[model samples]
Target: MSLDKRKQAFINLGHFLNQFNSNGIVKKENVLHNDLFFDAFKMQIKRAEEYNSWFTQNNVLFALESWTNALHHQNIYEWLKDYTIAKDSSKTIAIIMAGNIPLVGFHDFLCVAITGNKVLAKLSSNDKYFIPLIAKYLEYIEPSFKGKFMFTEEKLQDFDGVIATGSNNTARYFDYYFGKHPHIIRQSRNAVAVLDGTETHEQLEALSDDIFRYYGLGCRSISKIFVPEDYDFDKLFKAVYKHKDILKYTKYVNNYDYNKAVYLMSLFDMKENGFLMIKEDTSYASPIATLFYESYTDLEILKEKLNNDSDKIQCISTELNIADSVKLGQTQAPKLWNYADNVDTVKFLLEL
Candidate 1:
């Protein structure tokens, strides 16, 4: 299939997704394949929530909107213009997906299809439905996509390259098994925010979205923050208070209660409003409903430390002009070109 046909299929998928919003589902007239997919997709979204308690309706809608925003003609063109994509390769690329957030591995699937390579995907059990539904949608739109994609629950085999996302422990296993093949083995990485005392309330509220969205499961979620030595938690707490409804989710509430009790028992100094907790710690990966914070004395020193530990960081959210930092609140809304772990996935496929 031509790249334009592949791109158009995704754009059509985006249009189908555009109808869903936080308020409610509203089907639009003349959407391609709506008669076939609209109601089925809604049922799948419901199934997603039942399958994983963390996959709430609002979060699923947010993920759909993010993809809708990304799958535009201009965005697709801009992302691929820099790459010299191979047009005639039958290379099969195996992808082992992570189900931390909804459709988290869609980018890799899209990249392989767009680069004229076949994708052999082993779907994570936690996210077994959504992507396959999308693959069916694409196949319906562009029939040529039928042979270009395959999903497996069994072990992956017969692929030229591999892209695997998992925790640090699984990365070691990935290296041992797929070491000889060209591969992109991703390990756990957490995002962080650097706060100056001068940030407006609006920016801090946006930061709260970064911290709380997806129940803090995504790697791009802000699990930690760096603030000035004498920084006051008053403003931060006030801004984040708007998202207190997250506490209503039973899994998050359970985590918050359990972690809070453990912290208190350990006699750690921590601050909590009703829903969220912030503790002073050195770790980047915080537990659910809890955010780790650290105080820095020198901006230059902090910058050097973050830069040195780049591999451990997925993204840095800040209003300050730090190198390679994402703006506050835009961490989850990554552009099509924002490759995970700062690894150029399209480039990897093209070379393969």
Candidate 2:
């Protein structure tokens, strides 16, 4: 199939996703294949939380909304214009996706589809449902996509390259198994924010979205923050207080109760606003419901420190001059070109 054909398939999928939003899932008139897919997708969105307690309806809607925005005609064209593909390149690329968030692996799938390469995906059990349905939808839209991608539960085989996302522990096994093939193996990395005690309440509130969205399961979620010595915790607490409703989710509250008890038992100093907690620590990846914080005396020195530890960091949220820094609220809503872990999947596929 032509690249334009596949692009149109995804554009149609975007229009399908556009119908389901937080406001309401109002079926649109122009979305292709809606007669068959519209109701099924709406049911999937509503049932996501049942399959995975973390996949609340709101989170699923957010993911759909984000993808709806990303798969626009102009956005897809702009993102692909800079790359040159072999046109005839059709290697089967193996994708091992992490299930930390809804459709977390779709970006890799998009890169493979856009590059005209076949995708052999090993779906994460936590996120298995939506992608297959999406694949079926695409096949109906562009029949050529039918056999270009396949999902499997057994071991992966007959693939030219691999892209795997997992924790640091699983990455070791990925290296052991897929070491010979060209691969992009991603490990657990958390985002962090830098605070200079001058950020407006609006910025801090935006930062809260980065921290709390998706229940802080994504690698791009802000798990830690770097603040000046005299930074007021009250400011952050007040800003993020808007998301206290997250405590209504039983899983999150259970984690909150458990992690807080452990912290108190260990004699660690921390503060909480009944929903979220901030603790002074140097670690980049914090537990659920807790945001680790560190105080720095010198901004440049801290920047240097974080830079030296780049592999453990995903994206920094700040107004400061830090490398790979994103705006306070923009971490989760990354552009399609904002490659994960700074690895360009499209470039990898083109070379393969």
Candidate 3:
């Protein structure tokens, strides 16, 4: 496709999306309704059970809206002008998908798909079916892209640019293997929060979504809490405890048990329940189904520390007065433009 044609293709896709009424699909797909995009969210929630928890019907709506808005904001069609791979149709991009969360590899997939590069995707064991089904929907939108994407189990080599998502430990292996090659490696990360006394009972209850949503498996979930020294922890606990129904997820409870026992064995004085934990620390993010608390005196110092610790942090959700340089989240659900894992995806792929 010509550059103009490619740009128009995206623009046309956006327009089509606006007109794309999926009410029937939403009902057929069994997407439960919520306040956010009542129709679209239902479709996405239906898609959630197929793979990574993050890519569900609920988030897909949010993802598409956010991703689409971001594209418009960044003028991605123009940014992609120079990166279009027309003559190099044979160039293949290898994507090692992460099953830790839903569609964690999706933005990278979009990079390849929208840029017209062939994608050789390696499915995570946990999310083997999610992407393909969504891709099937794409086939209806762009029939030409059908053969351009592939799901694979074999090891990848000789790909132009690799995008791999994995743990901090596995990142070392990816670095040694594909690091020298042109690639973007997303290592493990966790998000945290800096809380002031300004939070209300309602805000605190909503904050529970930030912690327990997806059973605390997502990278965006708050793993730790930072508070003022004189702040009352009881109020925070009381607020979060109101949403105790979230603890019913069997898998979440299992993780809480595993972590709580480990804490007890190590002599850590902490409170635990079926789905959440309260640990004391100067940390921003914690492990699954766990939360760490720390006292901060100065917001500026905490901001510096958070910026310094950006690699370990995915996002900082707070009522604190944070600079615009840092990303902010009020509750659990992220806004459309909030990039995952704090990575500059367009820049990363454009460089590739």
- Which tens-of-lDDT digit does each residue in 179-264 have in candidate 2? 99999999999999999999999999999999999999999999999999978999999999899889778999999999999999
Give one digit per residue, the lDDT tens place, for model 1 in 112-138: 888889989998888989988888988
The lDDT-based order of candidates, best leading, equals: 1, 2, 3
Clashes of each: 0, 0, 9
Specify the poorest-scoring 10-residue window by lDDT in model 1. Answer: 80-89
Q: What tens digits encode model 3's per-residue C-alpha lDDT throughout 1-352? A: 3434434445544443332232222222222112223444345457566544434444444444444444452465445545434522556888988876555666677667766677889988876654675565456445576687788787786588888888888888888998777778888778777887778877677677677655667777778888888887677778777658756555556777788889989999876654567889765557677889887898889899888888888777766567533323343444334556656555555456
| Cα-based lDDT for every prediction | 0.91, 0.91, 0.64
TM-score of each: 0.98, 0.98, 0.77
RMSD of 2: 1.0
Q: Which residue pairs overlap in candidate 3's backbone?
A: 44-56, 44-57, 44-58, 45-57, 45-58, 48-56, 52-102, 54-102, 55-102
Tally clashes: model 3.
9
Candidate 1 lDDT (Cα, 0 to 1): 0.91
